[model samples]
Target: MKKYIKPYYYYYYYYYFYMAEKIGIRTATIVIKDNRLLLVNSKYSDGDYYLFPGGGLESNETIEEGAIRETLEETGVEIKIEKLIHINEFIYSNDWNKRSLTIFFLAKPISIRKNNLTDDGGKIKQVEWVDISKLDEIDIRPRILADILMKAKGDFDTISLNHSVDYKHES
Candidate 1:
Protein backbone atom coordinates (compact mmCIF):
# COMPACT_ATOMS: atom_id res chain seq x y z
CA MET A 1 0.00 0.00 0.00
CA LYS A 2 1.15 3.52 -0.79
CA LYS A 3 0.91 6.45 1.57
CA TYR A 4 -1.48 9.25 0.60
CA ILE A 5 -0.68 12.91 1.13
CA LYS A 6 -2.79 16.02 0.55
CA PRO A 7 -1.43 18.50 -1.96
CA TYR A 8 -2.64 21.54 0.03
CA TYR A 9 -0.58 20.48 3.07
CA TYR A 10 2.54 19.92 1.00
CA TYR A 11 2.44 22.98 -1.26
CA TYR A 12 3.51 26.46 -0.14
CA TYR A 13 0.73 28.83 0.87
CA TYR A 14 1.44 31.51 -1.75
CA TYR A 15 2.11 28.95 -4.46
CA TYR A 16 -1.23 27.33 -3.75
CA PHE A 17 -2.90 30.72 -3.75
CA TYR A 18 -1.31 31.52 -7.09
CA MET A 19 -2.21 28.17 -8.58
CA ALA A 20 -5.80 28.58 -7.49
CA GLU A 21 -5.89 32.19 -8.67
CA LYS A 22 -7.30 33.31 -5.37
CA ILE A 23 -7.10 36.57 -3.53
CA GLY A 24 -3.49 37.66 -2.94
CA ILE A 25 -3.35 40.07 -0.03
CA ARG A 26 -0.83 42.90 -0.22
CA THR A 27 -0.08 45.77 2.16
CA ALA A 28 0.74 49.41 1.51
CA THR A 29 1.18 52.52 3.61
CA ILE A 30 0.03 56.05 2.92
CA VAL A 31 3.00 57.94 4.37
CA ILE A 32 1.96 61.59 4.70
CA LYS A 33 4.63 63.87 6.06
CA ASP A 34 4.32 67.64 5.94
CA ASN A 35 1.01 67.15 4.07
CA ARG A 36 2.69 65.42 1.12
CA LEU A 37 2.13 61.82 0.12
CA LEU A 38 5.07 59.52 -0.49
CA LEU A 39 4.87 57.96 -3.92
CA VAL A 40 7.13 55.89 -6.14
CA ASN A 41 7.19 57.03 -9.75
CA SER A 42 8.00 54.14 -12.03
CA LYS A 43 8.22 54.24 -15.80
CA TYR A 44 6.26 51.48 -17.45
CA SER A 45 5.18 50.65 -20.99
CA ASP A 46 1.86 52.40 -20.52
CA GLY A 47 3.46 55.44 -18.85
CA ASP A 48 4.76 56.69 -15.54
CA TYR A 49 2.61 55.30 -12.77
CA TYR A 50 2.77 56.37 -9.14
CA LEU A 51 2.11 53.87 -6.36
CA PHE A 52 2.20 53.78 -2.58
CA PRO A 53 5.18 52.33 -0.70
CA GLY A 54 4.43 48.68 -0.09
CA GLY A 55 4.20 45.20 -1.56
CA GLY A 56 2.65 41.73 -1.17
CA LEU A 57 2.61 40.22 2.31
CA GLU A 58 5.25 37.61 2.98
CA SER A 59 4.79 34.14 4.47
CA ASN A 60 4.51 33.93 8.27
CA GLU A 61 4.51 37.73 8.59
CA THR A 62 1.79 39.81 10.16
CA ILE A 63 0.09 42.48 8.04
CA GLU A 64 1.54 45.28 10.17
CA GLU A 65 5.01 43.78 10.02
CA GLY A 66 4.79 43.21 6.28
CA ALA A 67 3.53 46.76 5.74
CA ILE A 68 6.50 48.24 7.56
CA ARG A 69 8.95 45.92 5.80
CA GLU A 70 7.58 46.69 2.35
CA THR A 71 7.60 50.44 2.90
CA LEU A 72 11.26 50.37 3.88
CA GLU A 73 12.22 48.05 1.04
CA GLU A 74 10.53 50.14 -1.63
CA THR A 75 10.93 53.69 -0.36
CA GLY A 76 13.92 53.54 1.93
CA VAL A 77 11.76 54.81 4.76
CA GLU A 78 10.49 53.27 7.95
CA ILE A 79 6.89 54.02 8.81
CA LYS A 80 4.85 53.84 11.96
CA ILE A 81 1.73 51.92 11.05
CA GLU A 82 -1.54 53.68 11.71
CA LYS A 83 -5.18 52.91 10.93
CA LEU A 84 -6.35 51.01 7.88
CA ILE A 85 -7.96 53.27 5.27
CA HIS A 86 -8.90 51.17 2.30
CA ILE A 87 -9.06 47.59 1.01
CA ASN A 88 -8.91 47.44 -2.75
CA GLU A 89 -9.34 44.52 -5.14
CA PHE A 90 -7.34 44.98 -8.31
CA ILE A 91 -8.77 43.01 -11.23
CA TYR A 92 -6.72 43.29 -14.35
CA SER A 93 -8.86 43.10 -17.47
CA ASN A 94 -5.90 41.84 -19.41
CA ASP A 95 -5.48 38.96 -17.01
CA TRP A 96 -8.69 38.24 -15.16
CA ASN A 97 -7.32 34.96 -13.81
CA LYS A 98 -5.05 36.84 -11.39
CA ARG A 99 -6.25 39.13 -8.64
CA SER A 100 -4.88 40.98 -5.62
CA LEU A 101 -6.25 42.61 -2.52
CA THR A 102 -4.41 45.77 -1.49
CA ILE A 103 -4.75 46.88 2.10
CA PHE A 104 -3.92 50.56 2.41
CA PHE A 105 -3.03 51.99 5.74
CA LEU A 106 -2.40 55.51 6.91
CA ALA A 107 1.08 55.65 8.37
CA LYS A 108 3.78 58.16 9.26
CA PRO A 109 7.46 58.03 8.43
CA ILE A 110 9.60 57.20 11.46
CA SER A 111 12.97 57.03 9.69
CA ILE A 112 14.62 57.12 6.29
CA ARG A 113 16.97 54.37 5.08
CA LYS A 114 18.52 53.61 1.69
CA ASN A 115 15.97 52.68 -0.99
CA ASN A 116 16.32 49.02 -1.85
CA LEU A 117 14.24 46.65 -3.99
CA THR A 118 13.98 43.30 -2.28
CA ASP A 119 11.13 42.03 -4.47
CA ASP A 120 12.71 42.62 -7.87
CA GLY A 121 10.58 45.68 -8.79
CA GLY A 122 12.32 47.63 -11.49
CA LYS A 123 14.44 50.59 -10.40
CA ILE A 124 12.21 53.29 -9.01
CA LYS A 125 12.53 56.27 -11.36
CA GLN A 126 11.79 58.75 -8.63
CA VAL A 127 10.46 58.79 -5.10
CA GLU A 128 8.61 62.06 -4.67
CA TRP A 129 6.54 63.73 -2.00
CA VAL A 130 3.49 64.53 -4.08
CA ASP A 131 1.35 67.45 -3.14
CA ILE A 132 -2.32 66.63 -2.65
CA SER A 133 -3.41 69.49 -4.87
CA LYS A 134 -1.10 68.32 -7.65
CA LEU A 135 -2.20 64.68 -7.70
CA ASP A 136 -4.37 65.10 -10.77
CA GLU A 137 -1.34 65.68 -12.97
CA ILE A 138 0.14 62.21 -12.69
CA ASP A 139 -1.31 58.75 -13.28
CA ILE A 140 -1.57 56.63 -10.16
CA ARG A 141 -2.26 52.95 -9.81
CA PRO A 142 -5.42 51.46 -8.29
CA ARG A 143 -6.99 54.77 -9.41
CA ILE A 144 -7.85 55.72 -5.86
CA LEU A 145 -5.38 58.50 -5.11
CA ALA A 146 -8.15 61.06 -5.09
CA ASP A 147 -10.29 59.15 -2.63
CA ILE A 148 -7.30 58.34 -0.45
CA LEU A 149 -6.29 61.98 -0.36
CA MET A 150 -9.82 63.05 0.50
CA LYS A 151 -10.42 60.49 3.22
CA ALA A 152 -7.01 60.27 4.81
CA LYS A 153 -8.18 58.81 8.09
CA GLY A 154 -10.88 56.79 9.83
CA ASP A 155 -13.29 54.35 8.16
CA PHE A 156 -12.33 51.92 5.43
CA ASP A 157 -13.24 51.90 1.75
CA THR A 158 -13.20 49.21 -0.90
CA ILE A 159 -12.83 49.66 -4.65
CA SER A 160 -13.00 47.00 -7.36
CA LEU A 161 -11.02 48.25 -10.32
CA ASN A 162 -10.11 46.89 -13.73
CA HIS A 163 -6.82 48.42 -14.76
CA SER A 164 -3.41 47.85 -16.27
CA VAL A 165 -0.77 46.68 -13.87
CA ASP A 166 2.21 44.69 -15.11
CA TYR A 167 1.77 41.66 -12.89
CA LYS A 168 3.82 38.96 -14.57
CA HIS A 169 3.18 35.36 -13.65
CA GLU A 170 6.08 32.95 -13.51
CA SER A 171 6.04 30.04 -15.94
Candidate 2:
Protein backbone atom coordinates (compact mmCIF):
# COMPACT_ATOMS: atom_id res chain seq x y z
CA MET A 1 0.00 0.00 0.00
CA LYS A 2 1.16 3.57 -0.87
CA LYS A 3 0.38 6.77 1.01
CA TYR A 4 -1.36 9.62 -0.77
CA ILE A 5 0.00 13.21 -0.72
CA LYS A 6 -2.19 16.31 -0.99
CA PRO A 7 -2.07 18.19 -4.31
CA TYR A 8 -1.48 21.48 -2.51
CA TYR A 9 1.85 20.12 -1.20
CA TYR A 10 3.30 20.32 -4.71
CA TYR A 11 2.17 23.91 -5.03
CA TYR A 12 3.91 24.83 -1.79
CA TYR A 13 7.12 23.12 -2.89
CA TYR A 14 7.18 25.10 -6.18
CA TYR A 15 6.37 28.32 -4.41
CA TYR A 16 9.29 27.85 -2.04
CA PHE A 17 11.73 27.35 -4.92
CA TYR A 18 10.35 30.37 -6.73
CA MET A 19 10.75 32.58 -3.71
CA ALA A 20 14.30 31.35 -3.17
CA GLU A 21 15.58 32.41 -6.58
CA LYS A 22 18.56 34.71 -6.21
CA ILE A 23 18.71 38.20 -7.70
CA GLY A 24 21.89 40.12 -8.47
CA ILE A 25 22.02 43.81 -7.60
CA ARG A 26 23.70 46.17 -10.04
CA THR A 27 24.32 49.91 -10.15
CA ALA A 28 25.07 52.31 -12.96
CA THR A 29 26.04 55.97 -12.95
CA ILE A 30 24.83 58.30 -15.68
CA VAL A 31 27.41 61.02 -15.93
CA ILE A 32 26.63 63.66 -18.52
CA LYS A 33 28.83 66.62 -19.29
CA ASP A 34 28.74 69.07 -22.16
CA ASN A 35 25.96 67.17 -23.86
CA ARG A 36 27.94 63.96 -23.89
CA LEU A 37 27.38 60.77 -21.90
CA LEU A 38 30.16 58.77 -20.29
CA LEU A 39 30.17 55.20 -21.50
CA VAL A 40 32.43 52.19 -21.47
CA ASN A 41 33.02 49.95 -24.44
CA SER A 42 32.96 46.53 -22.84
CA LYS A 43 34.03 43.33 -24.51
CA TYR A 44 31.85 40.27 -24.20
CA SER A 45 31.78 36.74 -25.59
CA ASP A 46 29.87 37.92 -28.63
CA GLY A 47 31.55 41.28 -29.20
CA ASP A 48 31.87 44.76 -27.80
CA TYR A 49 29.00 46.99 -26.68
CA TYR A 50 28.62 50.41 -25.14
CA LEU A 51 27.34 50.52 -21.58
CA PHE A 52 27.17 52.94 -18.69
CA PRO A 53 29.94 52.89 -16.06
CA GLY A 54 28.67 50.50 -13.42
CA GLY A 55 28.69 46.91 -12.27
CA GLY A 56 27.52 44.39 -9.68
CA LEU A 57 27.15 45.66 -6.14
CA GLU A 58 28.99 44.11 -3.25
CA SER A 59 27.13 42.96 -0.16
CA ASN A 60 28.93 45.44 2.11
CA GLU A 61 28.52 48.52 -0.05
CA THR A 62 25.51 50.73 -0.52
CA ILE A 63 24.03 51.40 -3.96
CA GLU A 64 25.63 54.84 -4.18
CA GLU A 65 29.01 53.49 -3.14
CA GLY A 66 28.78 50.71 -5.68
CA ALA A 67 28.04 53.16 -8.48
CA ILE A 68 30.91 55.43 -7.52
CA ARG A 69 33.36 52.53 -7.28
CA GLU A 70 32.28 51.04 -10.58
CA THR A 71 32.57 54.37 -12.40
CA LEU A 72 36.01 55.01 -11.02
CA GLU A 73 37.16 51.53 -11.89
CA GLU A 74 35.81 51.65 -15.42
CA THR A 75 36.40 55.30 -16.39
CA GLY A 76 38.77 56.64 -13.79
CA VAL A 77 36.18 59.25 -13.02
CA GLU A 78 35.24 60.16 -9.48
CA ILE A 79 31.58 61.05 -9.15
CA LYS A 80 29.08 62.07 -6.50
CA ILE A 81 25.69 60.47 -6.98
CA GLU A 82 22.98 63.11 -7.32
CA LYS A 83 19.80 61.10 -7.35
CA LEU A 84 18.22 57.83 -8.30
CA ILE A 85 16.99 58.10 -11.85
CA HIS A 86 15.87 54.69 -12.93
CA ILE A 87 15.43 51.14 -11.69
CA ASN A 88 15.69 48.43 -14.31
CA GLU A 89 14.74 44.82 -13.69
CA PHE A 90 16.37 42.58 -16.29
CA ILE A 91 15.59 38.90 -16.72
CA TYR A 92 16.90 36.41 -19.21
CA SER A 93 14.42 34.10 -20.85
CA ASN A 94 17.05 31.52 -21.68
CA ASP A 95 18.00 31.08 -18.05
CA TRP A 96 15.70 31.46 -15.11
CA ASN A 97 18.67 31.53 -12.73
CA LYS A 98 19.86 34.86 -14.11
CA ARG A 99 18.12 37.98 -12.89
CA SER A 100 19.36 41.49 -12.19
CA LEU A 101 18.05 44.56 -10.41
CA THR A 102 19.94 47.54 -11.80
CA ILE A 103 19.75 50.90 -10.13
CA PHE A 104 20.60 53.91 -12.28
CA PHE A 105 21.79 57.11 -10.68
CA LEU A 106 22.38 60.59 -12.02
CA ALA A 107 25.79 61.72 -10.84
CA LYS A 108 28.10 64.70 -11.12
CA PRO A 109 31.74 64.32 -11.92
CA ILE A 110 34.04 65.39 -9.13
CA SER A 111 37.36 64.70 -10.87
CA ILE A 112 38.86 62.54 -13.55
CA ARG A 113 42.21 60.93 -13.01
CA LYS A 114 44.42 61.32 -16.05
CA ASN A 115 46.05 58.16 -17.45
CA ASN A 116 44.65 56.02 -14.68
CA LEU A 117 42.08 54.01 -16.51
CA THR A 118 41.67 50.65 -14.79
CA ASP A 119 40.30 47.42 -16.18
CA ASP A 120 37.03 46.03 -14.83
CA GLY A 121 37.69 42.27 -14.79
CA GLY A 122 39.22 42.80 -18.25
CA LYS A 123 35.83 43.64 -19.74
CA ILE A 124 36.10 47.38 -20.38
CA LYS A 125 37.97 48.16 -23.56
CA GLN A 126 37.89 51.93 -23.72
CA VAL A 127 35.99 54.57 -21.81
CA GLU A 128 34.85 57.56 -23.83
CA TRP A 129 32.29 60.32 -23.78
CA VAL A 130 29.73 59.92 -26.53
CA ASP A 131 27.44 62.57 -27.86
CA ILE A 132 23.89 62.06 -26.66
CA SER A 133 22.54 62.60 -30.19
CA LYS A 134 24.72 59.82 -31.57
CA LEU A 135 23.47 57.17 -29.14
CA ASP A 136 21.03 55.88 -31.73
CA GLU A 137 23.85 55.03 -34.12
CA ILE A 138 25.78 52.86 -31.68
CA ASP A 139 25.37 49.33 -30.35
CA ILE A 140 23.86 49.69 -26.90
CA ARG A 141 22.33 46.82 -25.01
CA PRO A 142 18.65 46.96 -24.03
CA ARG A 143 17.98 49.14 -27.08
CA ILE A 144 15.09 50.79 -25.21
CA LEU A 145 17.67 52.63 -23.13
CA ALA A 146 18.65 54.77 -26.09
CA ASP A 147 15.04 55.71 -26.72
CA ILE A 148 14.51 56.56 -23.08
CA LEU A 149 17.58 58.76 -22.84
CA MET A 150 16.70 60.56 -26.04
CA LYS A 151 13.29 61.49 -24.74
CA ALA A 152 14.50 62.30 -21.23
CA LYS A 153 14.90 66.00 -20.72
CA GLY A 154 16.83 65.67 -17.45
CA ASP A 155 13.98 63.86 -15.75
CA PHE A 156 14.63 60.26 -14.70
CA ASP A 157 11.71 58.79 -12.82
CA THR A 158 11.27 55.64 -14.82
CA ILE A 159 11.01 52.00 -13.76
CA SER A 160 11.65 49.48 -16.49
CA LEU A 161 10.81 45.78 -16.05
CA ASN A 162 12.09 44.36 -19.30
CA HIS A 163 12.13 40.68 -20.21
CA SER A 164 13.79 40.50 -23.58
CA VAL A 165 16.49 38.43 -25.25
CA ASP A 166 18.24 41.61 -26.28
CA TYR A 167 20.40 41.55 -23.13
CA LYS A 168 23.07 38.88 -22.98
CA HIS A 169 24.18 37.46 -19.65
CA GLU A 170 27.88 37.30 -18.82
CA SER A 171 29.40 33.88 -19.02
Candidate 3:
Protein backbone atom coordinates (compact mmCIF):
# COMPACT_ATOMS: atom_id res chain seq x y z
CA MET A 1 0.00 0.00 0.00
CA LYS A 2 1.54 3.27 -1.09
CA LYS A 3 0.82 6.09 1.28
CA TYR A 4 0.19 9.62 0.07
CA ILE A 5 3.01 12.12 0.20
CA LYS A 6 2.24 15.81 -0.17
CA PRO A 7 3.56 17.81 -3.12
CA TYR A 8 5.81 19.90 -0.88
CA TYR A 9 7.31 16.74 0.60
CA TYR A 10 8.20 15.44 -2.84
CA TYR A 11 9.92 18.71 -3.65
CA TYR A 12 11.88 18.55 -0.42
CA TYR A 13 12.84 14.94 -1.05
CA TYR A 14 14.12 15.57 -4.56
CA TYR A 15 15.97 18.70 -3.50
CA TYR A 16 17.76 16.85 -0.74
CA PHE A 17 18.60 14.00 -3.09
CA TYR A 18 20.02 16.42 -5.62
CA MET A 19 22.20 18.11 -3.03
CA ALA A 20 23.50 14.75 -1.77
CA GLU A 21 24.43 13.77 -5.30
CA LYS A 22 26.36 17.00 -5.71
CA ILE A 23 28.73 16.51 -2.76
CA GLY A 24 29.33 13.05 -1.24
CA ILE A 25 31.96 12.78 1.49
CA ARG A 26 32.82 9.32 2.80
CA THR A 27 35.22 7.83 5.33
CA ALA A 28 37.00 4.47 5.65
CA THR A 29 38.76 3.01 8.66
CA ILE A 30 41.71 0.61 8.82
CA VAL A 31 41.22 -1.60 11.84
CA ILE A 32 43.92 -4.19 12.40
CA LYS A 33 43.61 -6.66 15.26
CA ASP A 34 45.42 -9.90 15.96
CA ASN A 35 47.14 -9.76 12.57
CA ARG A 36 43.80 -9.47 10.78
CA LEU A 37 41.76 -6.63 9.36
CA LEU A 38 38.00 -6.09 9.62
CA LEU A 39 36.07 -5.89 6.36
CA VAL A 40 32.53 -5.87 5.06
CA ASN A 41 31.62 -8.05 2.09
CA SER A 42 28.99 -6.71 -0.27
CA LYS A 43 27.29 -8.76 -2.98
CA TYR A 44 25.59 -7.11 -5.92
CA SER A 45 24.21 -8.12 -9.31
CA ASP A 46 27.35 -7.01 -11.13
CA GLY A 47 29.82 -8.55 -8.66
CA ASP A 48 31.11 -8.61 -5.09
CA TYR A 49 33.13 -5.92 -3.34
CA TYR A 50 34.70 -5.54 0.11
CA LEU A 51 34.50 -2.30 2.08
CA PHE A 52 36.40 -1.05 5.05
CA PRO A 53 34.12 -0.25 7.98
CA GLY A 54 33.03 3.33 7.33
CA GLY A 55 30.46 5.61 5.72
CA GLY A 56 29.43 9.16 4.87
CA LEU A 57 30.21 12.04 7.21
CA GLU A 58 27.15 13.50 8.89
CA SER A 59 26.12 17.12 8.45
CA ASN A 60 27.19 18.38 11.88
CA GLU A 61 29.90 15.86 12.81
CA THR A 62 33.63 15.93 12.27
CA ILE A 63 35.36 13.28 10.17
CA GLU A 64 36.65 11.49 13.27
CA GLU A 65 33.22 11.45 14.90
CA GLY A 66 31.59 10.12 11.77
CA ALA A 67 34.31 7.46 11.49
CA ILE A 68 33.63 6.18 14.98
CA ARG A 69 29.85 6.36 14.58
CA GLU A 70 29.80 4.68 11.19
CA THR A 71 32.13 1.94 12.38
CA LEU A 72 29.85 1.10 15.25
CA GLU A 73 26.78 1.25 13.03
CA GLU A 74 28.21 -1.04 10.37
CA THR A 75 30.20 -3.47 12.53
CA GLY A 76 28.60 -3.26 15.97
CA VAL A 77 31.92 -2.33 17.49
CA GLU A 78 33.09 0.81 19.22
CA ILE A 79 36.30 2.30 17.83
CA LYS A 80 38.87 4.92 18.66
CA ILE A 81 40.17 6.69 15.60
CA GLU A 82 43.94 7.02 15.86
CA LYS A 83 45.34 8.82 12.82
CA LEU A 84 44.53 9.84 9.27
CA ILE A 85 46.13 7.67 6.63
CA HIS A 86 45.13 9.53 3.50
CA ILE A 87 42.64 11.86 1.86
CA ASN A 88 41.84 10.92 -1.70
CA GLU A 89 39.29 12.37 -4.08
CA PHE A 90 37.57 9.83 -6.31
CA ILE A 91 35.49 11.06 -9.23
CA TYR A 92 33.16 8.48 -10.71
CA SER A 93 29.58 8.27 -11.94
CA ASN A 94 27.13 5.49 -12.76
CA ASP A 95 23.49 6.63 -13.12
CA TRP A 96 23.70 9.63 -10.82
CA ASN A 97 26.74 11.87 -10.75
CA LYS A 98 28.88 10.99 -7.72
CA ARG A 99 32.15 12.53 -6.60
CA SER A 100 33.40 11.72 -3.15
CA LEU A 101 36.54 12.61 -1.25
CA THR A 102 37.15 9.64 1.03
CA ILE A 103 39.09 10.15 4.22
CA PHE A 104 40.97 7.02 5.26
CA PHE A 105 41.84 6.60 8.92
CA LEU A 106 43.77 4.29 11.18
CA ALA A 107 41.56 3.18 14.05
CA LYS A 108 41.38 0.60 16.80
CA PRO A 109 38.27 -1.21 17.95
CA ILE A 110 37.60 -0.55 21.62
CA SER A 111 35.09 -3.39 22.05
CA ILE A 112 33.09 -5.84 20.01
CA ARG A 113 29.48 -5.30 20.95
CA LYS A 114 28.14 -7.89 18.52
CA ASN A 115 29.51 -10.93 16.74
CA ASN A 116 27.51 -10.47 13.55
CA LEU A 117 27.20 -7.66 11.04
CA THR A 118 24.54 -5.04 11.82
CA ASP A 119 21.95 -3.93 9.29
CA ASP A 120 23.28 -1.58 6.60
CA GLY A 121 19.76 -1.60 5.09
CA GLY A 122 20.91 -4.66 3.04
CA LYS A 123 23.97 -3.05 1.45
CA ILE A 124 26.46 -5.28 3.24
CA LYS A 125 25.89 -9.04 3.38
CA GLN A 126 28.56 -10.25 5.82
CA VAL A 127 31.42 -9.09 8.01
CA GLU A 128 34.66 -10.99 8.35
CA TRP A 129 38.05 -10.61 9.99
CA VAL A 130 40.46 -11.25 7.17
CA ASP A 131 44.10 -12.02 7.59
CA ILE A 132 46.34 -9.19 6.44
CA SER A 133 48.37 -11.43 4.17
CA LYS A 134 45.30 -12.82 2.40
CA LEU A 135 44.03 -9.49 1.13
CA ASP A 136 45.36 -10.50 -2.26
CA GLU A 137 42.54 -13.04 -2.64
CA ILE A 138 39.64 -10.63 -2.16
CA ASP A 139 38.35 -7.69 -4.18
CA ILE A 140 39.04 -4.53 -2.19
CA ARG A 141 38.25 -1.14 -3.66
CA PRO A 142 40.37 1.96 -4.13
CA ARG A 143 42.94 -0.73 -5.04
CA ILE A 144 45.43 1.01 -2.75
CA LEU A 145 43.94 0.27 0.67
CA ALA A 146 45.72 -3.01 1.30
CA ASP A 147 49.08 -1.64 0.29
CA ILE A 148 48.49 1.39 2.51
CA LEU A 149 47.78 -0.91 5.48
CA MET A 150 50.89 -2.98 4.89
CA LYS A 151 53.07 0.10 5.14
CA ALA A 152 51.36 1.45 8.25
CA LYS A 153 53.81 0.04 10.78
CA GLY A 154 56.83 1.03 8.71
CA ASP A 155 56.97 4.49 7.13
CA PHE A 156 53.29 5.37 6.89
CA ASP A 157 54.25 8.73 8.35
CA THR A 158 55.97 9.58 5.08
CA ILE A 159 53.25 8.57 2.66
CA SER A 160 52.02 11.37 0.41
CA LEU A 161 48.28 11.91 0.53
CA ASN A 162 45.60 13.86 -1.35
CA HIS A 163 46.47 11.96 -4.51
CA SER A 164 43.65 12.14 -7.02
CA VAL A 165 42.60 9.15 -9.13
CA ASP A 166 40.26 10.01 -12.02
CA TYR A 167 37.97 7.27 -13.35
CA LYS A 168 35.82 9.66 -15.39
CA HIS A 169 35.40 8.77 -19.03
CA GLU A 170 36.03 10.76 -22.22
CA SER A 171 32.39 11.05 -23.02
Model 2 lDDT on a 0 to 1 scale: 0.79
TM-scores vs. true structure, each candidate:
0.73, 0.80, 0.75
Model 1 stretches astray by more than 4 angstroms: 1-19, 115-121, 151-171
Q: In candidate 2, what are the lDDT values of residues 6-125, reduced to their tens digit? A: 556776887777755667899998899887899888898898889888888888999999999889988999999988877777776667666788888888889999467764578888
**Candidate 2: segments with Cα more than 4 A from true spot:** 1-19, 157-167
Would you list the C-alpha lDDT of every candidate in the order shown?
0.71, 0.79, 0.74
In model 1, the Cα lDDT at residue 12 comes to 68
Best by lDDT: 2
**Model 1: lowest-lDDT 10 consecutive positions:** 162-171
Which residue runs does candidate 3 get wrong by more than 4 Å? 1-21, 93-98, 115-118, 151-155, 159-171
Q: Would you list the clashing residue pairs of candidate 3?
A: none
Clashes of each: 0, 0, 0
lDDT of 3: 0.74
| Minimal lDDT window, size 10, model 3 | 162-171
lDDT of 1: 0.71
Which pairs clash in the backbone of model 1?
none
lDDT of 1 by residue, 6-71 (tens): 554557665666566766788888888887889988766667788887777889999899999988
